[model samples]
Target: MINQVSILGNLATAPRQEVLPSGTVKVSFLLAYNSYYTDRSGQQQEKAEFFWVETFGRSAVNAGKFLVQGQQVAVAGQLSGGNIRLENGSYRNCTAIRAEQIEYLSKPQSRTADPDVEPAVANVEF
Candidate 1:
């Protein structure tokens, strides 16, 4: 079965990065998407939806360093659903994306480093 999903959205929050005990890296972030529709009364309506996205390994490292809140990003990944327990002890189904590839659609100008300085890529390990 095919389980791939792609989304282009703005970052709702900053990316959080962590390294596990096994030395694996992880990054998590929230993405916001907007939908526009025409109502029956001929009025335009807009709705926003948020999704959780996770990346691992080298992708996680890049995401952590380059992504920030309000930046536009394009992500291709697999969607999965899980059950979350609420504070009232009720179970709720939640969906998230396990990002396999990510692209920066829009980013702040300051995010770029000085052209005179070379990026250190030799030290980065996958």
Candidate 2:
């Protein structure tokens, strides 16, 4: 069965990086998307949904470098299902995306480069 999904959304949090005991890198983050729908009354409404995204290897490394909280990104990957056990002794079904590819759509407007940091581009034309 094909288990692929693609989504374009805003990052809900900063990408967290971790190094496993075996020396592999893992990066994880949440992506939030807004869905618009019309009710029977014909009024438009918006609803927000969040997804967990995980990436490894070069994809993880690059995601950590270029992605930040609130940035717009497009992710393509497969959905994997698991379970989360709460402290209350209840198990919650969980689903997450194992991202194979990521694309940066836009950056946060409030982000600015520091004077000490070099510009990403030496020259550019609009």
Candidate 3:
């Protein structure tokens, strides 16, 4: 079965990076998607949904370096589910998108105004 999934959303939190015991790089972030609908009373309603996204290897490194909170991005990947251990020592089931491709929909806010510095790449896929 095809497990492809794609989403365009804003980053809710800055990407977090970690190195696994096996020495692989991992990055994760929360994405927020907004939707609008017409209510029965003819009023417009807006709703937002959040998703957890994860990337590995080269993509993970790029995401950690270039992505920032509130930045718009498009992600293409597959849904993955696993259990995560909580601080209380209990494990909870979680679902996340395993990103294979990420495209920056909007330019990241520059941290410096130096004209000599290079800009972040707009699209990354691995």
Candidate 4:
């Protein structure tokens, strides 16, 4: 079964990055998705949801460098289902996703974006 998801949201906080023992990079961020509409009273109403998103490998590393709190971004990934093991010998089945491609929705600050990043997306298979 395919478990892909695409979302466009604003980063609630800075992307936290770390390097694993195996040399793979990890990046995490909080994204807030919102919806708006006119209510019965003719007032605009907005609803929002916050999600904790993460990525692995080079993409994860780039996310940490290019993304910041409040920046808008778009991402596509596969949802993951796993369990969180507690110190009390309990487990909590949790939900998350691994990103495949992430794009910043905001305009570039200058002619040069993040120099560390490739100008275009790479065609590498995971």
| Per-model CA lDDT versus the true structure | 0.78, 0.77, 0.79, 0.71
Q: Who is ahead in lDDT, 3 or 4? A: 3
lDDT of 2 by residue, 1-126 (tens): 899999998887678898779887899877788899999999999987767788998899899888987788999999987553445667656567899999998886653655454212211110
RMSD of 4: 10.2
**Where in model 2 is the C-alpha error above 4 Å?**
82-94, 111-126
Name the candidate, 2 or 3, with the larger lDDT value.
3
Name the best candidate (by TM-score).
2
Candidate 1 structure quality by residue, lDDT tens digits, 21-61? 98989998777888999999999999877677889999999
RMSD (Å) per prediction: 9.8, 10.1, 8.1, 10.2
The CA-based lDDT of model 2 is what? 0.77
Per-residue lDDT of model 4, residues 71-123, tens digit only: 78998998776553445667655455678899988833433655564222211
CA lDDT, candidate 4, residue 9: 81
* Per-model TM values vs. the true structure: 0.75, 0.77, 0.74, 0.66
Candidate 4's C-alpha lDDT?
Answer: 0.71
Stretches of model 3 off by over 4 angstroms after superposition: 82-95, 108-126
- In model 2, how large is the Cα lDDT of residue 62? 91
Best-to-worst order by TM-score is 2, 1, 3, 4
